[model samples]
Target: MADLVAELAAAARNHTALARRVLSDLEAGCRSAPECELRDLIATSRTVPPARWNQLLPGARGIYPDACWPEARLVVEVDSRAFHGFGDAPERTERRRARYASMGWTVLPVALRRIRTEPEQVLAEIEAAYRAVLSRRD
Candidate 1:
């Protein structure tokens, strides 16, 4: 951890005041950075992995998400049927979905094919999901 801090400090000092800004962001408990570069193609506020990342799944400690809007408790997890293999027991999937809902999340699962071929549609749907949750305050 010390080594990581020293390296980050050096890298930040070398760049535009981003070091201090990054440090501040970290100190503010913003760890577990985004997992997907798809963030670059979308417009949103700090779409990073959740702060309470591990809690994303009970009895699981490293449930790092792909993209999440912490304020809205919305997460967009990318799935690829070709790569991940259609391999989850129906009961397991049901339990996981129930846990996510209990955790106050509006989880959005997006297929890799849709993201690669129809990015605009995916973005729109993501934006809509975020907005829907944001409006739940009333």
Candidate 2:
């Protein structure tokens, strides 16, 4: 899908600015709107470390996090109530987080509402988590 966009952008004669931006975001592994927003925030922030979107972490037991700084062993998951509020989804999320924790992965969960309303705070938390994890390594 991203390849198609890149090709289209390359072939276009004019007005490819938005397509280029979308292609860049897609290349950065952003699969959702929230992930793209986070990617933009991280990209623009000097304090926050860059993270790969929708990547599989090492020792994650097949779980692909929404965003991750693999070097710092930190993961950010955007949890939306629409997805996790039903049945045992919340429990499953908790269990998955526990698994990550047990494997030494720092899972930082951000609510979808918070992502929309408190982006700065979310970036702050991500910076804090990255610092905390790196500090522990040192």
Candidate 3:
């Protein structure tokens, strides 16, 4: 059992490394936990999983969403205080979300603080956003 646990840990480390590398190449990468990756993996069967795309939102040019399910027209934005949570950053983000909404993208902005406090709710909202977009598509 110990050996199996060791192997699993090793595999997880390897996968996380690969995931981080891929995310690094993209514009909007998650600098937090493996939540973004988990969402991608978990979204497989139930919905179109998100991936690290250099250009996630078309016609937006420099805007790169953290993760997006293009088929569902959904985008996930993770906010970090260290990066975009100070000064006018919050306001800028609100404008960005508004712009994305104008483009008909259902944006889900989750704060790192909120994720730490209400993780389950954040996950539930993500799923709900997926369902909302999915229903809109149909």
Tens digits of per-residue lDDT for model 1 on 11-78?
Answer: 74555466555554455444433323245346343333333322344333445455566788776766
The models' CA-based lDDT, in order, is 0.58, 0.81, 0.66
Which has the higher lDDT value, candidate number 1 or candidate number 3?
A: 3
Stretches off by above 4 angstroms in model 1 are 1-37, 43-62, 82-84, 89-94
TM-score of 1: 0.56
Question: Which clashing pairs does model 3 show?
Answer: none
Compare the candidates by TM-score and give the number of the best one: 2
- Clashes per candidate (backbone, < 3 Å): 0, 0, 0
lDDT by residue (1-138, candidate 3, tens digit) is: 455445555675744765444444332444445445444443443443555543548768678887777778788777778657789997888888889989988887777677667766677777787888798788
Query: lDDT winner among the candidates?
Result: 2
- Candidate 3 versus truth, CA RMSD in Å, comes to 7.4
Residues forming the 10-long window of minimal summed lDDT in candidate 2: 52-61
List TM-score per model, in order. Answer: 0.56, 0.86, 0.63
lDDT of 2 by residue, 1-138 (tens): 856875885785588777777778888888877777778777777866678787777765578888888888888888877666789999989888888888889888888788779888888888888899999999
